[model samples]
Target: MSPENNPSSGIVSQLESWAKRNINPLFSKDTWITLGEYIGLGRPVSNRPITTARELGSFVSSRSSHVAQSALYGYLKTRAGTRFPELFENPKMLASINLAKWHIYIACISDLAAYMGVLLHLRTGSDNDKVVRLMSRVVDDIVDEIGMPDEAGDDFHESVEALKIRIENMDFSMHEDGDAVFSVSPDALYKWSPIADELKRFDRTPVKNSVRFRWKDVRETARNLFDAQAVIESFGEPGSSGSA
Candidate 1:
């Protein structure tokens, strides 16, 4: 397909829109539904949390079309006890349970979108690509809101610079066995853990960092944007969902 007519052009716009909308501090439930649709996973039609990890995993597994599958499954499985311990341990609190599930669904979609962007970057290894550039902006916006300490600035810049070098260096190489390889090593991607780690810290923080990170919906969205790449990579390349 011609670059201008590529389906990804539209998908990039949709992904950009979703990223921008979710970055807002005050998103409604309807906004959540729209974000879900952007990821090719429609919003939950009902108000109940999936009662078990297996069910939650299955629900996400059915909806996913990219590399974020395993990470989503693992996040849903552990989120109840870790992120929303009160709601997870006490199923009797129907209101809280419903709210927690709603948050989880939103988180799953954000993470799915964020990781998909990362994989697209890794696949093409191009900083100039529309999708990768959009994803990079999303990452920068999320981290900026999280408010990194001044002392952490150098480390952050160094890590980011290293990641850039790695991305630029990605190209075909000959193996000893005479095989041509055109991919990134998993470890190379793992170096990006600093960004993902900072995102998770914000995700799990009890104190509100920003209006964007204060709300459960946006917080989850930020966390997902910086989620670990290796885990997301485990599910393999989940090619694009096609035009919108």
Candidate 2:
């Protein structure tokens, strides 16, 4: 589609509108349900919390199209989580669970859309052109102010790698190769995971005393630890609902 012919314009526009309405520090659950209510499927969400995956699942089950449920969960999930702190702080853990469920939900819908040829990129390792392109684009917009990756420097890639190795190395069982140990690694140690290795193994740039580390700098990077496709595949396929 041409730049002017964006198919997601309507849906994407609606999403953007939701973002504007729920600007940080002043979110309202009632307003958040605008899109889901528009779809007229999920449970009636109010200013109250939609606490469990079961609740999320029940809401998902009551929906019609998988796409509809996916999209609704997208909004609910976005609003409910602390995944992006700038957007939502120390949010209840349930929100994070739901957000994860939402991501899984939509990723599955996107895959289905691609499977039916309605959307492409339904399968793994394919270019974003397949299915995630629109999503990746929309997600970029959705999380732009929350955590704009564009603003960061090239320093991210390696920093991110170090983080992943730490996450992966934590517990020899997790070693994709079943070959190491590290553990939760949190956010900091993960980034520092490689300092020792890099310093010892390669001629690395010395750490400047002035360089400050921030989670925003590391959060996106930490996300790189998991095999994204594998994450998607876990929730993919039609019958594979968000439960369990």
Per-residue error for 174 in candidate 1, Å, reads 24
For every model shown, what is its TM-score relative to the native structure? 0.23, 0.20
Candidate 2: Cα lDDT at 201:
34
On residues 1-244, what C-alpha lDDT tens digit does candidate 1 reach at each position? 8858755555555545654654434344444343344344422423233332222233233332222222222333343332222222344543332333333332333433333444444544434344433433333333344344343333444444443343333322211111112122122122222224554454432211221122234223323433223322322222532111
Q: Which parts of model 2 are misplaced by more than 4 Å? A: 2-5, 16-151, 167-171, 174-244
**Whole-model lDDT, model 2:** 0.31
lDDT to native, each model: 0.34, 0.31
What local lDDT score does residue 180 receive in model 2, on the 0 to 100 scale? 15
Over the stretch 1-244, how does candidate 2's per-residue lDDT look in tens digits? 8745743444445544656665455344443344434344333433222232222222222221233333333343443453322333334433433333333333322222222111112223444332233333222222232232432234434433443333223222111211011111122222322223434233222121111121122222223332334333333233444331
- Model 1 is weakest, by summed lDDT over 10 consecutive residues, at 174-183
Off by over 4 Å in 1: 1-92, 132-242
Top lDDT model: 1
Clashing pairs in model 1?
66-238
